[model samples]
Target chain A: MKKVTQILSLMMAIFFLVSSMGNAQSKNKVRKMEYNSKYNYEVATIAVGVDGTKLVKVWGYGPKPEEAIRHAKELAIACAIFRGFPPASNGAAAKTPPIVTDDSVIEKYAEFFDNFFAPGGKYLQYVNLSTDAPPTGEDRVKVNKKTYKVGVVLSIAFDELRKDLEKEGIARRLDAGF
Target chain B: MKTLVNFIFIIALALNSFGQAKKPTIMVVPSDRLCISKGFSQTFDNQGTQETLPDYKKALQNDGDLRLVISKMSGMMADRGFPLKDLEQELKNLAQEAAESNMMTSSSSGSAISESPIDILKRTAKADIIMDLDFEIKRQGPNKYIVFTLNGLDAYTSKNVASASGAGQPSSAATPEILLEEAVLSYMDEFNGRLMTHFQDMFTNGREVKVMIKTFANAGISLEDDYDISGNTDMLSMHIEDWMANNTQGGRFNLSDGTANFMRFEQVRIATEIERNGKMRAQDTRMFVNELSKYLRTNCQIESKVYLRGLGEAWLIVGEK
Candidate 1:
């Protein structure tokens, strides 16, 4: 009977110790975002830099890292073109209008606009800014497959772009600053 | 069926009217140079900063040019049904009250709640808009003409919402008062229209409030720290989101930017209240920072110091308590 009593006391002590340890761990445990594991899709991230007057930032994503970066430069050029020749009348919810051309008397030159935005284009010069690291914190989402987020900041002389855009009739030369 | 339709129509009308805001109160003051030239300004220290502000007290003293201009402007506004706040009279009252209160309260225990002169003016008058006048009487060959500039500013933000400037046709009026009045009245319609449009936008879209939240560098704490074991979100961040949603009318707030240690909220619309200063009143934005600070202290267990600039922007530091 003495041995049995000693065994019971030891069991009780072990149970309490386990329970307290669990409780302490639980006290410090925090919640984190849950992402789907079933979807094997790549997540693309883009962040815009809006500070420099003539420098515009762009980001693109692809299957490979280099391809993603190359795509980002193209995106940067596209961004510059859009910024220069922005549709003034379009509201946030407005639908994109179809581009049309007469083709005989006037050339559409859509490809010309793209060529200017392309890397080493005459109207624009590219200056690469620092690449952004992945966002950190509890809110950061995890993806199942390999993902790519590539970006670049292009330094395009806006005055040149403005003048070219005006010549192309894409933008007016009226002074925006009063 | 007819009675039911009538009841529904009445309800709709009431709801429409409820969303509409009443006319805002306005106060007119001469521009700094004009005030100084006309002897409406005085030199004084605001808190620890020594600067010159318009002394409505001296300006309101009997038979001053600023007083005459303000009175005429007030009459014009009153005729248009817009409420007018007399800055001079209000300042005088405030001075009298401060003197009386100071005599009764001992110096050892200064009032825990102290307001700056501008704050007292804002609190008392509850004027939403301040109209600043910069006028000069130009002496043409045979007549004296008024060359005036009018700026409608948000009392809280100090943002110039509307402005108008033009030279009035020369009038052979006997006094500068009549000449100025005639000049102002000539453009008053357009000026008042601009003022009304700005106030209407504020009423419909809600007033803009800019808020910046920052944490101390050495506090061993960040906005991303998880305070609750059962939740995954950061403690301060979640609380800020909830506060912005709950405090703004109709959840009318935009979280413009957010990072681990900083957050910027723009276009926040706090519910405006009609406060009385003497008999004049307007919708006021005073409750925003007070309520936000109180929430941070109570719920997050984090004390914050709120720094308000003008009326519309508030800066809060979490570790500065």
Candidate 2:
């Protein structure tokens, strides 16, 4: 009877462990986009990155690394143009990614970006500038079989800190002896 | 039942067809003179010696402070709304390339020599932001007066707004703290509010607007004979926040309320690359202006004024540079 009890307890522990792992993966679904398409074809790569920290999307795909990079750049630029630089129009979500372009690589590109920025990866991407750049700690993410890299997304949210930005004379760089 | 099902389907489709607003990111470029030294030899020399420019550093620190201050400026022009996920990867990739170049791995994939914002600044040399600044102190009796010259401020399409590359001296006699404060304050007054709009037109519209102011610091200009003190003299005369703003700076102007449906005049800067031999050497001042214009262009409407001392007036950006 004692031996039977021990085996039952062991089975319970394994079941719990498996359940926890499943929960963890589910939580990470948003970070690492699950393939939404009907098919999971043989893909050479499926990397991901954030959309300027404004929009969290996945983006990456190619038969090779260069092709993946090209697809990623194309996706990133589409996002950039959608935001439209400096944002003349107000009431717009500052950190949200612009409308994802409906292109051939949209799905893979968005996924790559989302994974690149989620959770960790700050140390690898941004320059310190020694200014008020947001905290980009030693966060890392691995994609395309490459070692983990910084995934921190820094967006200077000036609206919240408008008073501070103006008082610092940020525009003085244009003049003499600046 | 059929109608309700169709309505629900339409609602779902509508929700999917929306754009999530986003803030853009802007990487600022420092002044031109501070970017690189004159000629390749000077660049090689100063870079070889790592002595920090305490004054320039101070100014940069001040700009950092100002960035905080401007974050408070309301309406459209605020913090640079950036798309981080997309940009971070691009920057990371670029950073990787840069690291590879520094390592001198010529065979490395994506081995292009990545330019730091500073490198970009130097390559484009000219812009509204002056790179290097110089000063000459002349002791007159009990008071020591300093003459400061700004270099690398490019003029616009017309020759009216002159570049301050060689020198445009503005004299002053104030304490160090006061000198720095006054220099920033006074200059800002000359270029804030609607003035930003006016400035943007010059830069993006093809017309340029450049101004140089020289002020004296508390201790006066110290160590005047430094070889590394030459400023980057070619900077843009104006600022353009929009692509369509690029127009030729010339011809008719009603001058009514200092604005018109379309207007053009001089008082501008030009953006021209300066290169000698097959190797490139210099860039015009518009580079910095271009950077600044990015901030403003994102806005739908801009409202501001130019203030000199206590006097202020509303203005607008229009026409070509």
Candidate 3:
């Protein structure tokens, strides 16, 4: 009977059980630690080419880091879907339907892992790591569609802060020369 | 005197014959159907356009340290000998298990990093083995743009201060989402690759095996919440394992890119039994497990004990992801 029960139970488990039972420590572990970020400034301004190097800005604002990450992912997807990232008034607005709901962009990004564009970037690699040397103007990075020159920066906003904000002017460098 | 010496020699020989710790036959192989890349799940839509991360919050929430977790998690699966079939099958099983357990089957989900410090040589079974890999992050400076230096930290506990691991410190620009992603991804790559390898090996030998991974980590998204400092190791291990032996691993994970998706454990262990043609004695199976454990201890700092059970002429296996 014991062996039969074991077999039946194992079979039932095999048939239906999805998650294994976990008996972890009862106490919840919550550690609060902070470290200096290595990536450079945060604010980034991208130039939209066509109407004489006009800057097409992708605005990202959030109260928490989750919100910030969520915002950043949305902006990345928007950049990918739209022909010119942050399609400025000057450049063309190539119509492409948003891939996911406004609420589910981060879930999409977390589905995979890779840094193919980082080292292999030849055009404009806009890596905004929390480091000292933030990606700067005309730097090279690889976008989903193609690579381009970009101006990347990282910074933390403080109260009554100075205006480190920026604007850019761009046209399809592919068609028109700088 | 001669008899006494002989007895001592026999005991010493017995101890020495078993040898060292056994390395896990673990691998994180790529799924033949999907590839996870850069916290993004890429799959061709009916229109042939790549369906990428549309929900950035889901992406960020699940983007728990892809690179760092892959790198560090590889250490847990350093044995490099698990059948590839076992790795792949087990990872898939664990995923199905996730669904069974009613986890956040949201389109994209990143699990927590919970470490279980089991007794090195505790009660381990041969049919199913359990292990816990613990890691901590260290920062070199402060601010959102500060440098982060990682190291293996040890947790300490006092009367008031329960414990600390490595160099636990606070940062000014602490983003729970970012930190969780970084910590989870840093050591998970090894797991992804190994899963592929382990499964490949299992299938190659015409044996069916399973690998279950139990994940432990924090869930809060606030910098103020100490998600990293929490504990859920044992429960996750057990839960994840239970999920795998059952067939149900397809969650919302898109594996087209092959880098972002990883193994998650709820509260169970991964159990895969191979039905082979031959048969073996229980003692012999134990001996093989003993040998494997001995080999692992020397090659990788995984575990100190091993268990081996008989299934026909084969063995059910478990290892790190």
Candidate 4:
């Protein structure tokens, strides 16, 4: 009986260890998926301002409209830095080049980006809602029963954002003199 | 140790300032094809053969739209801190110079020297890179759009260093200028990025130029002549190649063609600057070839006359001064 109890305890310990390791690996995979999804959708420029600002429409997906709308702001900033707007049919999209071309920069400066993109972080200072309220009608869509796809138009202070990145050593300055 | 540290710090500061001081000068011009298609070209007799060339003076003076476009592009580049040599302004300067030259004649021969308009512009501007712009406006029913192309070419070699092209979205009431501005805004950054890369490469690997070597008809020496260098017999051409290998940046150069009397060294990577007398000085094709000419004269007892065409090409005529 004693031997059986000892064996049972040992088996329980092994099971917990294995399960925790599996959970950690799956968590990393989920994090990677989330990061990639932020850049997967297309961002289009609605209007370009002469004062170094760009009004861009970005799409975000979440379980709720409010969550998706919030996520769209983050996506707007991310697309500005990483993935520039793609050309759309009938000249709908203004195919602006991204401020930073190297994608590996995210992984290289992971800590910096993580903090810069945190909730209510420095990225917020560069982008704002072009309109007073969240977009409705065609801009917001219910994808299936569990998810909402929301498109938000945000005004991004592109030049200021680029200067900030340069200050932070994340992007090269134009006048740095090659 | 303390004095050495101070000396090192000063040196670092000077080097940093030197790196920041140099930026490529750029000029924007309408592409030759665009000028021709828009009927802004004129024919001129070149050695008895009539050749059509872009008449930049006429284009700049007659086309208000072209002037506006050039100004817009120049403004954009200026915003990025690039020094721009305005094409229209340069053309006017050339015209003024031509008028001044035409008023004067040689006292002995009663003749005046003439240069082609393009040559005069090249000598006057000396732009490191030329931005060639071409655009077309297309209409679809009631909507109009613009497809534009921008190419950055090396002023000396005419090599395409950077290029960007795309079509803008159609609009019902957008003017050609608006469409062009929108189209270029998307790709300008990438184009400038490429231009920067090329300029940086020039600093690292050296500025590329072309060198040609020729022997005068009456010269007794030829490139095939054998030279005794430290008991090793090598041809005169071999000796010249060795010098090029030693002097050029990373020994980077191509001997494209060689014969008994002629040698062509294309893509010769020469240093942009060199340290002399404990000071860094700017270098060019003339200075680079002058060093080679000196080497030939001092070591091989050969005299050569170096004739430079523009800033990137040099011809060394052997056996003569």
Which DockQ values do the candidates obtain, in the order shown?
Answer: 0.01, 0.01, 0.01, 0.32
lDDT of 3 by residue, B1-321 (tens): 999999999977755444222222323222222123333354557687666533222333454443333443444234222231233245456557545545543455565333244322222222122112233334555633112222221111001111111212234575644453333332222223333333343323322222211112332111122211124333322322232334322221111111111232221211122222342111223443344344434433333333322321212232331
lDDT of 1 by residue, B1-321 (tens): 999999999988755544433445578866787767776677887899988776555655743656666776677666555647887767677778777755665468865446577555545544657898888888878777667788888765567887766665565554787666554544453465455556545655666667778887866567777654235355777877887897787898878898888888877776544334432223334447666778767756677777665456677777666
Tens-place lDDT per residue, model 2, B135-254, is 333455655433333322222221212122111112344543333232222222112322333344443443333312111233232212122212422212123212213422342112
Q: What does DockQ come to for candidate 3?
A: 0.01
> Residue B222 lDDT in model 2?
20
How many clashes in each structure?
Answer: 3, 134, 189, 1
Q: Residue by residue across A53-92, what tens digits does model 1's lDDT show?
A: 2333444455555655555555544444442212212110
Q: 3 or 4, which is superior by TM-score?
A: 4
Cα displacement (angstroms), candidate 1, residue B243, comes to 5.7
CAPRI tier of model 4: acceptable
Interface RMSD of each: 21.7, 20.3, 22.9, 3.2
Model 2 residue B103 lDDT? 74
Q: How far off is residue B75 in model 2, in Å?
A: 18
| TM-score of each candidate's B chain against the true B chain | 0.66, 0.28, 0.22, 0.84
What is the Cα root-mean-square deviation between model 3 and the actual structure? Answer: 32.2
Q: How much native contact recovery, as a fraction, does model 3 achieve? A: 0.00
